[model samples]
Target: MVRSTAPLLALCACLPDPLGRCQTNTDCERGPAGSFCAENVCQGPPRGSIEALPARFFARSETVHVRTIVDRSHGEPAVHVLLGSGAVAAAREPDGAFGADLPLRFAPAGSEGPVPFAVEVKDDLGHLTLLPGSIQIDDAPPRVSVDLASIPSPAAVRGSSVPLRVVVQDLTPVTLVWTAGGAQGAAMQQPDGSFIAAIDTSKAPAGAPSLDVAFTATDAVGNASAAHASIPLTRLKFVTRHDQPIASIVVSDVIWAIAQSEIWILHRDGTSLTKGSTDATPVAEAATDGHHVFFARSDDKVCRMGSDGSIQLCCGPFTPLTGGPILLGSNPIVSTRHTATTSSRLVAVLDSNGICNQMSWLTTVDFAAAMPAVGVDGIVYSGASQAIVAAKFDGSVWTGGHPTSETPSYRGQAAIQGNSVLVSTTSATIDTFASVPLNSDAPTPTTVQAAVAGTVISSPTLAEDGTVTIATNDKRIVALKTDGNIRWNATLLDNATASPTHGAGGLVYVGTAGGEIIALSGDDGSAIWSQKVGAPVRGPLAPGCDGLLYAATDASVVALVIDAAGLADSDWPRAGHDIRGSGDARRPLRSASGACLE
Candidate 1:
């Protein structure tokens, strides 16, 4: 056996000498982590290889667990982080991989760029390996805002599309999503580096006040930002509020109103007519003949205004008239104090030359209470003592009073239906109608009493089919046939202070003391729709030339959009026979035989 200085070295004989000198590969003690023979000497554990796993980019705010797979071919390997001071060994992961964690604080202070980093693997014999600059870190979040100039003036309209634009300031690619009015969608990138989206408002409520929009912008590296905006929305095409209690409204080419003192003129669609007022404040309701407006001024004079708002005629300064002016042919007629008795009244016809034809007949009876109704002939009918009498423009008695027993509703205007004159009256708590022959000189009294559900509170409105509709103090709407028979009676939420008016599609509209407007079907008295106005609606309700319903509430004159075209084609659709309050029933009509004749 070969002699050796140490016994441990003597057993192998291929071991390196104490001075670390070797003759061949077997001359050195070799293992996974032991010294290896190289160039006839014990060199070292061979340099090991290493790799950092799951290579990906990270934000500067993130902490990275750097997992490393180290080469174990030579010896038990170890992983380390190369710090500025010295190398620190990495701990063994649960899966037997060696790695270390790099915290967010590892990035140098005030560093915005990607942090340079490295990893090292070593064997038990002091060999080394490294992985450098294989990781990148992002620094900042995305900045997002809305381009205010791109928003529309009225940000949203019902049943229309609203567009939005977004601007983002970021170095990385970005994705944008938007939400508005319970809807969400992704925004499309524009060529100008902006994001664009269109919000659909077709399904929004008719009374919605506004539309809210929000945006979330996220960059490719997961940096996110948010933005928000509110767009004022228009609810409907026709909504206006005249800040005063309205007494009366007339709808023609223009909408006319007599508030406390001022006359408000609006387009048929509720837009401002821009027509300035020059005439004196009107005391009575305004009237129109489809060309000129007629109203009784506060100065106790009758004035005529052109549709363009110019004063055409102002006659009188006469005795106070109980009702407004009415048109008979080309002249205006009014009811004034009778020269005979303090309790009775007379009709004054204003001629083309402003001459007052103080026609007097029933100075012996109670005459001239409500506004008079004109027939197809030149006859004018005025209410009298328990009767309705006829008079010609030439101051001749066409017929004596038609007798009745019911008390005449001084506030209820009269109507001329077909062959007789229809008038509303009240007997104790019951309301009835008195009819008289239109063409008969020796008129016979025909009192048609209506058995209504409640006391009549409004004038009798006659439809084209001769159906009469009225409201009562008992919160009911009752319809009556020509012979005074009950047609239908519908319950109401409150007492209708305003007269029931007829509209298109056999619908009747009434305003309640509870500040609500209700639409009911004339055929069967079924509810159609209702809206609140926040104040008592005591004045008349006028349906406009457009699909709008104009109401005079205690607080304001409001215009609301509806589904009807205009007033119904009837004998007496609204108050005073027409929107003009003309009270003229001489217009051409289609008779029962379909004869279009007057």
Candidate 2:
């Protein structure tokens, strides 16, 4: 009996038939107010639809207002937003449209992209209409990064502009800005979607070790991301003073020099601290033990001066000196010869305070042309005629002579590296560079020899890689591999007046008689840059702790700015190796941070 009544009710419900039009729920329109879809026929309240809605949603907004166009044909209607969580009731606005506050509570955290939602409009007659899945949601921030490889070099010069490359990934467009060293600029986008920015270092401080560049990328909707890149920077500054400087050494940020027959102590800024008479014939540069300076006065005496400019003590007039004094521990040792050709050569050692210990002397010594080098084992090495001599102070014993070449010529300063002593000798007949082993235990401690194009006037310097860098009197700079093979050679613009010194970043610096201080790449022996002083540069380019290159020329002493914070981190970076010109390669004086010490 119930089945018979259902058949009659079904026929009455299809008064306005349209059965073929609605095959699925999607085929029906989302009507509002009174009208709804049933069997493809509108029934109950009058029809209405959602006219406007936000095209996208943001999770940070917390709530969204949805507007609907409802029909008044079915009296007053109620509007609601149906999210994945639950329904949110809507109220009529003053403009006549129904509005609903859709909270983000219905959205899962970290959810993004198109979030399907439904809108419903119901009338008093209980007829409903729906619109589903039309808006999108965005919750992700842009990905940001910096392309470090795109930076020009590890170091940037002051008052220069350097370019940086940036990368970002996001669904929306982003804007970028960069800041560094108190400078800021907008990042420009390239055709390939990468961004580029140029950093101006005009106002950046010259002494800072590096400049840090930061970038921030923001999307259209206020979601932001950040990235950073750091680049080392170099600022060039030159300080010149006409102090009549000759040879100089840097100790603890102070400059000590033999200037115009006087011992001058100066600040790195060229300000004179004190000056004292040196008996009119100050024969050598000053040496220090980090607190006091030792010098040779014309009276054939070894005098010690405190760093405060006062003479500490004076040792008795020793034999006529030939080269500058050097230190082994606290003792100031000097080289003396009665005459150039005479075999009457003496190596005298004096205690810390001016006390002479006639304990060590060599009668067979034929020549001592340059300052001697001391080994870590307290062995003093010098170049004698045709040989390299080693003398130890412990027992007043000499290691005898290790002959270098068959030719008898005076050798300049010696640079000791590891167990070997490197010496260069030049004469009318032959010019030789030798690396002789100090250890006598080897069956045949073969002397490694490398031929040079011309006379080597200064000691050889060792690169960090153990390559030997030397300057020749013939205006040439040469580098030799560890095996004594020629690595590279560079012909200088003029004859080198002093030894070549190593600087940070694999650079070699040398001064020339032409008044030009030149810098060369240690790796390839290529010219980097050269600055000309008004006078002949007479000595090594001294690297100071204040990031300045101190050069003593014939006319004036000048401080040239460099890109290094301190000296090069190499075995034998400079002539005489350290700032003191100690010539001891095995134990170059250095601070705990590896910076050269006085």
Candidate 3:
């Protein structure tokens, strides 16, 4: 056995080290750390300033870790580094930059750049010295830029295609991302710098949303550029609060008001929420009893449309007059100079005794048929249907008034109240029209009396209990007993043309050319309140649907609140003109019948 001074030396001589420490006895002349004197650690000539890629290069680059210089004395030399934490370790290439052979798969993140800690110089003597700036690392993040055309494109010509382009650039490779269209579409990225996407207008509506397109571009460094641009699109149909209706026609809850042309569903608040017809042709007058709508048709047919949009006509021979008469349920009323009242399908019209023209007669049509047409010359409700009943010239051709026992002085049209026809006829005769149930009833008025003589009868209105109220053009509102006797008399702003509509608060309303709507005590006809809505009162006034009053004027529609506390005067309608477009009927289109075609 070879005598050994240390057991370690003997073991080293026996086994071959894969570390390539020593090959022959001659190699041992350098010892475990190379060349004998070096102890503990052994290393070959440290790689010369390692050539790193991305020189001091960024982006995890490969590196070269190999001996650069050889030791003539053949001593162990190892590359080492001193850490900030007072630790010592192998010294890597001066630069952490990636090298070809010794690759650095990882890159320093959030750091200035590849950072080198310290470098160590080793000698065969087993001595080491830490060099403060032995390594040079990279610092600096990449700069990126993105280009976007933020201007929104024009409205796409309904059916066409448009291109949206975006460009993203970076000091390094860049990923371009984008989102197009809506949820139906998808988002994606094109590794390339600029991307162009096609937006088919053919798939869009007329007025498609040409909203600004949004996008973002980020370089590998996580730097981003926010972008925005308007896209051009086609048009189809778009509805928004931007759209406003020109006019609305409203009437009683159960009835449709014969407004300008179209049949509009009525609301108590005077708001006509339905889409009105823009046609020039007049339709028909309908009534809503707060529920279903009853249309008084002059075609001799009574039609009804429910609030739910259901439509049907009660079958009958009742024909509407050329000019539809005032409609009550299916019944239509019209007065003739010759005194013949005809309706939609009614073959038989009631005739009165009077000379055509000067003769005035109020004839009621069958409750079964007829529809009202549009225009002011169409239907006119007689203020009261008693003596001297108000006559209408529904544009057709019924001559003047005629004489009759129905009350020659009739003015106020009769209001049908629970089984009784209350006629506040001719300011003077307050009477009730009840078919006495004959032996099956009793003795009815064998002969109806006429107005005392000369006095002209004003229109009459009635209360729930058959009390008659009549108004004379003379500005006075008179109340009468159910038996044609005067109960009380009240005055008004001016000549009253319309019938009185009673309210729940024991108040009565009437319209007058006096340019004001007067409210009077239901019983005494005493003035309770007055409001001067713009323009002279035309016929009667529609009581508010929901505590508001509605008035018709050439200026426009207006609403007024019922203030029992005496609210001050105001001009709320003026403001409405600002929001709604100033009425401009420039559109060439006429009747919805497709009549006025260009």
Candidate 4:
């Protein structure tokens, strides 16, 4: 009984008590490396407290190195960087601080403002803590732009204060610099993110035939942009004609000026030769075949005179015409209003021995007020119906169907090239330059159409290469290929009312309502030169063989000498300078000498 009791006592002593040993963290202080007393057991230190150095700042394409100090009383802590949803482990430094490189680009692309980040610390016992922080992002640089208005005129006179305007755009304050004559100028900013600067040409260098102006614009972020322009300077020669506005001008061996009811001839030296008068009526316009000048009186009487102002022949009083007595192979084709009530008629008055032989007419509907363009095979004109009608000299006529179905309003005069006819039309529903084949038998001619942005206000001038030049009411001069493709365009300061004329050396001349004549390169539409005539020009430019450009303004006739070598002794004997009113003089007229009359 004693031996059994002793074994029971030993077993009872070996059994442990039911009460736990630890209740708080302080009770198990001397345990493992990261041990802490919790839940009646020793454990590691609580997740270390993370403190970031220099909490937050802005970054632009810069690396943000985050240094954090983690406090873990019981053991060292593992540190990491939380950028958005991604985590990057940090390296511990010799000073006991944790660091991680956070590139600003790590943020979302094109992101701005504060980017959230955190320094996280974890202990060996799996406890975690986070330190919240942020960084502002602004890495984009400011943009800059520059523009120059009216830098190059066709011709700028020396000592003239040519007006120049410069415009700049930038989000922040911009520094603008411009050089005119080593003289720098600054621009003032406007509320609409634009700056304006004016350049005075009077301060340019002496004897400078050309002026080169350079401009630079710098933004707040050190971004810069630049631009430049060139201007040509020349001397001007002016010729005055009648006191009243010169209605029309034609240059040959002599310059002819039509005003009121008389035609006066002026030599190159601006001397008046002789004056001829229409039979008590105003003439529409005159034409020349380099031998004789012919014009139609308002009373339907067609008169002919020599280039020297000698009266040749006068025949007509037949049918009343709206405009033109265009000479086709010495025969006159007039756009006549048959009776007081009829639409219109294109009458061909046949002449032999300077006498009217037989008069034949082509009846038309909706005939335009302008003259018909004469081709080798036929005559083309815009009908009142918005259709283009071509009347062959053999009495056969072909019509191009209406270009637009909505309304038919035609602008400018028709131009005939071989079997093709070019015309401009603008209506509420259509504004286009159409090339129609005159020989086509289709009821509605299939035309190559080029859309125009503005109302064409002048007759189309056909070039030697079949290109067509037309001026719009919006001051734009456009050139088109025979296939209706745009060749080039030039914008003027004011509306261009005069038709463009071709000259020697691939040059195209156009006159503006602002009294300015501009010469453009036919190849690329670049400005070759420009001149201000000081009066409104409403007539086409006539190129003389003397290398001079003859144009009539509101008050006088201007003969501009552009290229001396280009003068070819050609005669501008008529308004359009040719039988077809083509405004192209391909052959030199024998009547004029090689010497410049002016």
Candidate 5:
């Protein structure tokens, strides 16, 4: 050890060429498969050499991000990444690590699904490495569609409830958005391939109204598909029988009654119908007890039909007071007659000629024996049934006596209110005429005015305000009070020879000779609104539960909704749909290819 071996110096010279053309420690030490010698140091990689960062992809309106890290790549640790042309250089960090976030604003619409993207990386040594695969951008357009298997044209009626169907296909799971012109309501696509929706024209306005429904399917990726359908809404009127030519129509709660040969339900409107249905066997009399209507037929049959067509009773052809069935001796006279209900019981008039002895007079039936009615009062002045005639009681009845003071002749419907009874008179000149003063010995005249004349078919009906309304062959709606003073007269269209009907809220509804329905102001007799519909309506007006008017025509039954809010035409809802953000700026909806929902 004192002198040191002579071979040791030679061994140092042969150790490994430590300083030869190396930029890193790895260049000098090749230890394992993953390790290598570089430069003049024992580092991981050769100086200024790096692999590229992974490539990125972009989809519908999304972004891509990439990063490059430096770890012992040696020689100032410089790095640079290559991207598509026009790509700005991403800022590098002080530690030689760089990151970039690419805002992908190039997602296309109106195109099919599943698009593509690409990216690569590089190092300071001018070395490059591409990613294993290209990035995929799936910014596809939405898929929208419709079923053209069978196209159904719009019905003739204006504003009828109709349903349209369709199927849709799209990318990235989509939902269906429906718009009418500018109205909007999008429905979710069900698991089943088919879709169903209801478009209600009931709430839609009258006339040649234009309605366009557009269906658009948009995927979550913003892709979309669309289709459209257009329809015209025609106005309609209500009638009782669908087969017979409708003369006039009326709705009471649940039933739509028309004057077809006999009164029957044309259609069922609401949920509750008390007075079911009736026939034209000459209704001796009819009484409304709010919920139900009871009829006395000429055959001495007491039939009660709910407005809904539910047959409540068929009671009658009863045995007379003396013994036999209480019936008339004459073949022309009807036996079972009028009504005057009392609280806690129902009462009716029995037309009988004692022992069928060839003389026609009226007998009485107990309130308990008669058919029941809704709001009747027997007490000296309860409410609906305040007045009782001699023909309504059995014990003190007037048998071979003159007809009850409240007798109904072979004309039309009559209303008995308190001490005053309103009846419609048939004449040739005036549309409506009335004779009042029950106790007064008034003279019955053939005609009211010698100046004007026409064949009036129905008796004059009195309104709640004591104004009598009559329809005549002269095509006029005349209103008069008990004093015979004329309130007002409405001249109808010459060709429109149909009768008129009075509804609640003092509104007068009438049908014209030319298939038109007009609502008039009851107070001043002014036209509220008029619209032409279905076939020529021949029937009378029928009142609905909510003061709605039901009219009958030769074509079909129609219903009308009153405009109570009174909005201006231009200010109407859904009217501004023609303009929106993209041009017709109004609502968020895009199209109307289907039905409209309230």
Candidate 6:
């Protein structure tokens, strides 16, 4: 029995020890259906194998839905699945399968790269299974932003350079898309993720409206973002400032200006006509008749210079005219005074040699003031009694006086058409526009008065169709029909200080104190186009023979090509357009239909 017991013990020892203390798998026996001996201990099948499902590549600020299957074979049902800082409860199926819908949200401050995931499975004994493996977590996308504060002003002038700036946050490439004045192009990105696009408006189409700029950013992962801005373009083709303020401007073959009390001529292309100062300082506005420039000097002398800057004529010692001299066939008709304190004014028609050939005494009671208008029949001027007076060139008084009830404070020069004399008057409380018949015998002239609401400060421009265009102090431009009826009124950008210029195709051009040149329709007074020229326009706009419109600002002269038809050909050349100061240039100077001929 001892021997048999000894052999049995030896056989039991040779077999597997039930306590299961083994150094290798060869010393241990498989215990259960889903159990295995590991590290000399019997363990259940891995708590669960977590298999990550497909997911979309997300951005840093976006959330991703993680659909994973947790398999629990020998271990108990999985309670939850953990991925990064996000977790989800595992739903156990009847087939012992565990599935979890995990929402993994990557925080801005979270780690980027591969993320480790773990699953918690509980056995029947409350033991937990933690499975760990690396899954890629790519939530990094290039950041992009627009710097609107650094953007250029919405208003830009033509032929000017506009700068654009953009800011990007990543190393991703960037591009600038720009469309200005019907022009389109693309710009490359800089090293610092910033893009700078300089747009030159001179290269834009003739009538290009505004500038539209956009920026596009693309990340390394194909992510994209965009931003946009707009800028309104102006009609100013070019601007060149002078050392001194520009007092007046006249356009002929060359552009002339009174700056620094001297005459400066500029070519059509904005180049200097003369290498240096052309003439002596002038006391008043300058006038050009396409060949010779006439000006009044500080010494009360009226002088004429050739277009090439050669002095032609200088007549002086006589009383200086209140307004500039009126040129009629190479002669100057001026309102002069024999003595400094003389109450009566004389209308002197001077010869080409500056010698007064004819003189007519104007009847006066109070302050002698008049802007004379010369026509084919006679010379018409406003008398001191606010009446219309007429005289012939031979100093013969034709119409002594045609009195009106209201005071005639003529703001702009008078305009004559056919048998009618059109004048704009502004009193203390009323703005009156009158169309008076030219009758020497009629004691009371037939006057048709068109009352305006605001003060009329600019001269009335008469069209060939007998329509009238005028600018008022209230920043308004109005058109009047033949019978003095209101056609249309449009608001101006600022105070309309300069006279409205009538262009071809029934268009009117007006300048404002706000540095804007506005074009209005002659029929309805609707705004056609507006350009901010960057300086106050104080002088009249002259339509050139070319398609360009010339204007005088505080510091420079600007040329703009506003219309395709170009400026019309009119006998009226400078301000107060004609020699009669009629301001109407719709016809030739000798035409009987409203022609101011002497």
Best candidate (score: lDDT): 2
Q: At residue 555, give the lDDT of candidate 4.
A: 69
Per-residue lDDT of 551-598 in model 4, one digit per residue for the tens?
Answer: 788767777656532322223322354422433333333335544322
For candidate 5, which ten residues in a row score worst on lDDT?
575-584
Model 2, span 224-243: residue lDDT tens:
78898877655334444545
- Report the lDDT tens digits of candidate 3 across residue range 1-598: 8776798888877764545465444544454443332232233333334232233333333342422231232344555534333333343345432212323333243334335544455655455543443222222333323334523343543334455666654454444454444412322345564655554444432123454445555555444565555555422111111032212223444223444544454344344445333233333323343344443343333344556544433322232333233432223333222223342121212222221121222344222211111112222223222222212343244432221234323332334333333333333444544422211231132222223434444434445455556566566776666555677778665776555555445566676765676777767767765656555554444443244445443233444444321111111111010011111111111236523111
| lDDT (Cα) of model 5 | 0.41
**Estimated TM-score for each candidate:** 0.55, 0.59, 0.36, 0.51, 0.50, 0.55
lDDT of 1 at 54: 49
TM-score of 3: 0.36
In candidate 4, stretches whose alpha carbon ends up further than 4 angstroms from where it belongs are 1-235, 280-284, 307-312, 318-320, 337-343, 350-358, 378-384, 394-411, 428-454, 464-466, 481-483, 564-598
Please list the C-alpha lDDT of all candidates, in the order they appear. 0.64, 0.67, 0.39, 0.60, 0.41, 0.58
Model 5: residues with Cα > 4 Å off, grouped in runs: 1-62, 68-85, 93-97, 106-122, 130-140, 149-163, 180-184, 192-195, 198-203, 206-211, 223-226, 231-499, 502-508, 515-535, 546-598
**Residue 56, model 6: Cα distance from true site in angstroms:** 39
Off by over 4 Å in 6: 1-208, 211-234, 275-285, 336-343, 349-369, 376-385, 394-409, 428-439, 442-456, 565-575, 578-598
Q: Give the least accurate 10-residue stretch of model 1, judged by summed lDDT.
A: 427-436
Clashes (N, CA, C under 3 Å) per candidate: 3, 5, 98, 17, 87, 1
Indicate the residue-level lDDT of 566 in model 6.
Answer: 36
TM-score of 6: 0.55
User: What range of 10 consecutive residues in model 2 has the weakest lDDT sum?
Assistant: 427-436
Query: How big is the RMSD of model 1?
Result: 11.2
* Highest-scoring model, TM-score: 2
Inter-residue clash pairs, candidate 1? 32-74, 32-75, 33-75
